[model samples]
Target: MVVIKNKCISVSYSDPNFVIVVVAAAAVLLSLCVVPVSAAAAKQELKLRFGRNGEFKILQVADMHYANGKTTPCKDVLPSQVHGCSDLNTTAFLHRIISAEKPHLIVFTGDNIVGLDATDAAKSLNAAFAPATASNIPWVAVLGNHDQESTLSREGIMKHIATLKNSLSQVNPLGAHAIDGFGNYDLEIGGVKGTRFENKSVLNLYFLDSGDYSTVPSIPGYGWIKPSQQFWFERSSAKHRREYMSKPEAQKGPAPGLAYFHIPLPEFASFESTNFTGVRQEGISSASVNSGFFTTLVAAGDVKAVFTGHDHINDFCGELTGIQLCYAGGFGYHAYGKAGWKRRARVVEATLEKTEKGSWGAVKSIKTWKRLDDGHLTAVDGQVLWSKKSSGNRRKKQIPIT
Candidate 1:
C-alpha cells in the first residue's frame, strides 16, 4: 500500500531498543512498544537540516493567536480578546518547540497573528514569518479567522500575507507562498505528497479556503470563498483522483488523495449525526455555517481526509463527503486546548500509516510544551495527543526540552 500526506508531525523509530508507558489514558493501553529513530532534541545550528532520505522526527506545533508583531514565545497568556497581541513576547514560546523537535518542517494550522486594528500590527504579523522562515526549515500553513482582517476593519491582514509571500519568494521561493491568498498551501514532508497547492501529481490533498473570522464562512458573509470556488474545488478534486489514485472505483487507496482547509464545512459540523455527511445551505453568522465544499471534497473523501481548525476545543471529529474530517486542536488559539490543558501552544505530529491492503491513513498526536524565560521548549509539559493503535506502532515520547 502506498501512503500519502504533505504535512505530517511524527516520531521516528529506527531501532527497537526502547520502553513503553502511557501518560494519563492507560485504559486504552496508550502505553505500548516504543523505539527511537533519532534521539537527540531537534535544533537549528543557525541553519536547519532534515533527516536524510526525506526521513525526519516529529514535533508538535500549535496555533498562537499571538499579540505583538512577533513570533515570540507565549506561555499560558490566557485567552485575551482585548487586542494588542502584536506587542507580546512570543519568540521564547515559538523557540520552545523549534529548538526541541528541530523539525525539518513546521506545520501551522493558522490563527497566530492577531492584528486587530492597526496596519502596523498587520505588517508586523506579515514580518513575523521572518524568524521562522529564517530557520531555513520548510513550513505548511493555513489561515484562521484571526487571519481575517476583513471584519477587524483592517486591510493590513491581507497585506501582511501578500508581503510575507513576496519576502519568502525572494529568500526561499519554495518556503513561503499563499494558495492564492485564500488560506491554502501544500508542502512535502518525508517525501509524502499532500495539500491543496497547484501540484497535480502530489496525491491530490485538496485544501479549501473557507473564509470568515475562523468559523465556516457565513455564506454571503465577508471574507469567505464565493460559491464559485466550490465548483473549482469539485473539478480539481475529481481530476486529481483520476490522475493519481488509479483504483477510484472501490475508492480504496494505494494512492490516497486528501483535502485540508482552515474552516470546517457545514456537513462535517453535525454533532448529533456526527455523520459529517451533508450539503450546506449557508446561513446564520453566529452559529455554524455548512457548505457543499466539504461534500465536494469527500466525493473523493474515501481515499482522503479533510482536516481543519477553528472552534478549537478538545477537537471535533466527524466524517463527511466520504472523507475523515478531523478538527485537531489549534496551535496557539486560547480557547481550543481544553479549558485546563496546560502548556501555551501545541503542534500536531501526524504519521502516515499504510495498511496491508495498500490503504492510507494517518495517526495523529499532539505535543505541547512551555516557553522558558531563555526562549526554548520546556520538556516538562510536552505530551503525546494521539498515537497509531497498530499494536507496535506507538510513537516515541518527546525528550525533555530542558
Candidate 2:
C-alpha cells in the first residue's frame, strides 16, 4: 500500500523504518536551507587604521537614546512634553549610518540608552556597538546625563560596555581620576604610509564622561568634569607632547587632538557672543559651574576641537579661540528632540599634510559637516568648518591662532 506523509510519499508496508527514512530525508533538506550565522557572532576586535589617502573619517552618533525592549509609543512617554513620538529603531538607524559612511572609527558621544534595567541597557549598548564590530571597525563612547538614570550606575554600565568586542573604553585606572565616572581615556591615531606624517600619531582622540544631573542643590542643569579629570587631561596632553613632539626639535607642534564628551562646557557660551555659524536653535544646556576645563584645554594647546552631544535639537559648529566646537546633533527617537529636525550625525574628516614650518607631519585641516538621516547634508554654519593650521609652532603659516 502506498502512503503519503507531508512531502514524502512511500510504501506503507515496504519497511518498518520507512517513516524514519522520510523524516531523515526531510532533516537533510532542512539543513540545506538553514543559514549559518557569520563568525562575527563570536565577538572579535578590530584594529583601527587610517585611510589609504592618509585621511581619517570619524562618524559621531550622538544621543542614540536607545531604550530596551519594545519602543515606547510617543504618547506614552513620560512628562507628556517629550518630542518625536516615533518608535525608537536604534539598530536600524545605526546600521544605515555605518553602511553609508563607512567610518574608520565611530564615537558615541553620549546618552546611548535611557530608562532600562542594567541587563536591558547592556543589551541596548551592545546593539549600538554591533555595527562597528560586525564591520570590523573600532568604536568608543562616553556617558551622558541620562545613562545612569534607571537601574545602572556609571561604573556598572561601563563594566558591561568594556566587555563589548572592539570597544575602546576601560575602567579608569588613574587612581583619583577614576572618580565619579568611567571611560575617561585618550587614544592616538597614527599616520599612514606615502603620507607626509608616516612616523607618529597625526591625531589624538580624548574621551571623557560628562556626568548626570547634579546631586547638589547649588549646581544646576547637568554635572561638570571634576578638577581631578581636568588634571588628568592636562597631565596626559603634556606627557604626549613631552614624549612625541617636544623631544624632536624637527617635530614642531603638539599632536593635534579632539575631545569628545556628552555635555557642553560653559565656554560653549562664547559661541553666542562671537559671530558664530550653524544652527543655535536652543540655548546651551551646559553645567552651571564653569570647571575651567576649557581654560586648561586652551593652555595645553593640543586639543584643537571638541565635540559634544546632549542638546539634541541643536546641531552646529562654531569657532572659539581658534578651536572648533561642535555638536553631533540628536539621533534617537526615544529622546526629546524637535519634530521637524531630521535625525542627524556629525562627520569629522582629517588629513595629514606636510607642514612648511614644523615637522613634515601634522593634521593639516579638520573639516566637519552634518548629515541628516534622509541623506541631506549641511556644511557647518553654512560653510565647511576648517581647523586652524598647526599653531604649536612659532612659524607664520596662517593656521588659526587659538
Each model's TM-score? 0.53, 0.76
> What lDDT would each prediction earn against the true structure?
0.39, 0.65
**Which candidate leads in lDDT?**
2
Error of 2 at 303 (Å): 0.9
Give the per-residue Cα lDDT of candidate 1 at 384.
Answer: 34
**Candidate 2 segments whose C-alpha is farther than 4 A from its true place:** 1-49, 74-88, 116-119, 173-178, 193-199, 246-249, 354-360, 375-402
Candidate 1 Cα misplacement greater than 4 A, ranges? 1-63, 69-89, 117-119, 148-181, 184-204, 213-226, 245-254, 271-288, 316-322, 333-340, 343-402
**TM-score, prediction 2:** 0.76
Residue pairs clashing, model 2: 278-381, 389-399
Cα deviation in Å at residue 59, candidate 1? 6.6
